[model samples]
Target: MITDNTGGLPRYCHPYHGGWDVATIALNIPESRILFICPVTCARNICLNAINGGYKDRVDVLALTEDDIVSGSYEEKTVAAACEILDTVQPRPKAMILYVSCIDAMLGNDHSFQTEEIMSCYPDVTCFVLKMCPITRFSGDLPLVALQHDMYAPLPEEPVPHTDTVGFIGSNIALHPDNELIRILQDAGYRPLHIQACDRYEDYLAIRSAKVNLCLMPFGKTAGELLAERYGAKMIPYFARPDFTSIRTTITAVCNALDIALPDLDAMEAETVRILQECAAYIGDTELVIDSTATLFPDILRKTLTACGFRIRRIYADGVQQKAPDIDAGSIQMPLVRSYEDNENVIAIGMAASSFAGADKTVNMFYDNGEWGHYALRMLAARIRAAYEHPRSAVQVRKEARK
Candidate 1:
């Protein structure tokens, strides 16, 4: 577990030390149009999430099968099939992202060679390879996924002049409310030098010109450290939530770093309090049970729910011991359970695991959408209310119960 300055929850660490292969490839691909070729078994979710996050039209996905794994013929055949698909599709992508699974890594498959062969045959397209290790099975967390993406992205070409530019890094979470940060920065009269999101790599060489680096999330540690050492840029790491108080603190920190006058703290606090109160009213009386195998959102959910006046009855989270101190600080204490037991009155807040566990009512907040996780939190609340007003059908209840 890595602890931040605040002594809260620890940051989650990546499973494999060698770094994530697919994240690197995703970050570096220069072409606007992309294709994600994933190993059939383990990387399906990766491909699906990338596609769902607005990469749908620009990216095509192909899942590799077991026969390919057993025979060692998957590499050539898969590439060829992708090329054929591109040929028939008419408007082919500018580049292809070849994502290897744990099977490929364990089998000692060389994705670089396969990528080169495909690029050579196509001539007009570029290909990059990313190897995804089975982090969950081996080490329990996939923080390296974001890091690998950062690694493969091209470093910024030239440094912006150090006079007034700022860099925003490590904002891969789909629900990251960056608009608030942007508004705060604009109000503070600071012009952003650069803004890098998931898989958006800038040339490190040019990043030093910025006076400071504002790291929105922990994943940007690598880039932030590098910039600090090389370009003398100050790294201001901040954890953002939907609450306005957190936003105000973030703005104050940024202003302090730039030697700008602090904004009106009283007004900011008042506004934040009002917003939180309103949100609480909207979600008051709702009961929620958050379950996460990844452990990325338990604390986040706790804080958000608390702000919105939702009662969290229980949390099914793994990797609590490994999280960074700052992350765990705000985490609420709920009975940790491995499975849903007696969760009749509570609505589940996570992926669709409740359905399999036989929960009467379940809500899936996390779903694979190409590049980001879509927020269905509000939708889940609506459904819960509807279920309270009008119960589910017996047939439908039985169907879900069987799973």
Candidate 2:
């Protein structure tokens, strides 16, 4: 059931998508401070989001004025602001992100020159400039893509080698802590590098040491490229293309590049089957509603879940259309929904879908994040188990998701 909007564009999309986007992810970076240098008006939503996500203190805004815009001294002012932040903030910031808004897009200011001043002044705080122009979404970098690149901006020009380290780049959150991906890497004698796994500048700097990068989500593809260019590591992009058989192939490719032995694929497949059996037993007849944002490929994951004996009611996304027709899957696409009052006995994945579906149970699978491989299965099963204890209101679910 598609709700028609006046324009051809879908109501729920990037820039206006209901849940959190890259800006939140950027602010949540470890050992980093983000100073958003833009209009004060840009402050409210980001601040509210920061508060809700429990990281309000990590972000600050340097509101540029109309006079500054007209005088074209925004760049100079931005440099000064960085210096000020360095002097005032105790312990100093390891890195500062100078986020310029779309209003200043036309200025076409060369940010690096301005940032050089900040670097020269403080010589301690590592900073980079990021353009936050929504208008450039179609033409250039969206904040998500740009943040992925900037996150790696701190990589050292001359990296030290740590052959046993493996980096997981480009997912919003790190993979599930207990994920077999970690087990697989460990069994093969490689350590995993997740941003959150590091607390100090030195540990974070060691991101440069990974022998290979696994781009689990689409957003990470460019980050993987940047890492490859800087560290000469191989890039293996899964990019949310969900299919365990295909994913295993990609993992094999990554292992070959590192000269590490591949994990036991047959055992991996059996473990996945065992979890799905548990999901099927618990799910029973509960309708499973998927939102594209919940997994890298909703359709691909839909196929996988159905094979595990879950019932898919509907999906709140356009992704199913991109794949070849599967008569057996019988999946249908619906636009962003308003209510799912009729579907109470549901297991909803993705915040938007869970909000709309009003499922009795919901998983915190916001925009796929690192929900790939068996970790995806683990997270899904865990959500189902949690719902058995306390169910959430669809109204509460959707409203909280709007941030």
Candidate 3:
């Protein structure tokens, strides 16, 4: 399906950045494999993506046939294919996730009917059925939340709160390994938990023992609710945009949540200031065109960049709900890239930005580089420095490094 307006771009081009969403979370699990049940056409994209990502060995496709559609016998063929997968692979996967594409989601075919039989066939492997339909993006249990809920299901239903342990539930990308937030948590006499560090499934379940849970991403809201409902951990949502005040707010919120005094506020602000200075030095007076499709907080990002000497020509996102007063005052288009007047001079962010404006300097707000909080400033600065020469942006740096 052609999602949204493609801005007169090539029909075959991806609508946005190639994010697997919750499917990418499966990669974090040990000995896990994805059983992608999609059409032959979609399967081709999946196959090529896996190969390009160097994980083709882990992906298997169950392409649907015309006969299967006409006969409506997908349930049987799916079961048979899954059973065949169990018998064929060596050192079998510990978990096999059955992922249905958009077609199946609309068909209203429940694959759970065979869940019991599949488990019975292979008692050793854990199984789950996840919907991979992006069409349900705005609706309840969109792919990201649904997959996260299921992946986290392996953890205990009832978690025990531990005063010393604090957990963060959301995008792993935002939690940098060297995040200073972890240091603050430690100073407040608490250990930090961000799902990335959990190697074992038991470690993930162990989060129930945290005294407080911080929900970072919109998808993480469900995870936070699960932890709170089952484990009774306090779930605090962190949100603010369009200004630098959010950094101070987050720092204060973290302190309050942990029942500790605010950390040296002057010191944290100094760090934020230093990062902003670095960005200003590298990215001067260029008209920047930013898209919200990539970053979680484009409005906040917009205000921050503006304060640091960058001239934003356009913010391609609706800032009304996000409270980006600055963006609302500026040129906030649905993004008419092909009709854009200044593709050459503007610096763009996100794949959507890259698509429309065709900016030579692009900071693709890809998965990993979409940092949150004060640390986000540092990530953006460093990316700008690297991209200053070629204008490839932060995400493009990661992509090139892969080669």
Best by TM-score: 2
Candidate 3, position 371, lDDT: 57
- Model 1, 1-403: lDDT tens per residue? 4332224534342121111234323543333344454565454544444554444454455666667667777777767766776676656555565655566556766666766777788876666665456443344335453443334343444445675667665543333444444555666665564433333223323355778887655556666776777667898876444344555677678878888777566765565455544544655564655555312456565665566566666555554435634332212223233333433554554333343243444543332110111122333345545544543432355344311
Overall lDDT per candidate, in order of appearance: 0.50, 0.70, 0.67
**RMSD over all Cα atoms, model 2:** 3.9
- What local lDDT score does residue 98 receive in model 2, on the 0 to 100 scale? 80
How high is each candidate's TM-score? 0.59, 0.86, 0.82
Q: Give the alpha carbon lDDT tens digit for every residue of 1-403 in model 3.
A: 6554434444333344454444456655556777887787766666665777787787788888888877888778778888898889888877788878888867878777666778888988777787778777655676777766666665646546466788877664437655667778877778787656565555555687988887766767787887788888888776424345766787788888777888777787777777777677667776776666656666667677777777777666654444655443222343323543334656676655655565667665654353566676777667666555666533443354321
Once fitted onto the true fold, the runs of candidate 3 whose alpha carbons sit more than 4 angstroms away are 1-20, 154-163, 172-174, 186-191, 239-243, 318-343, 391-403
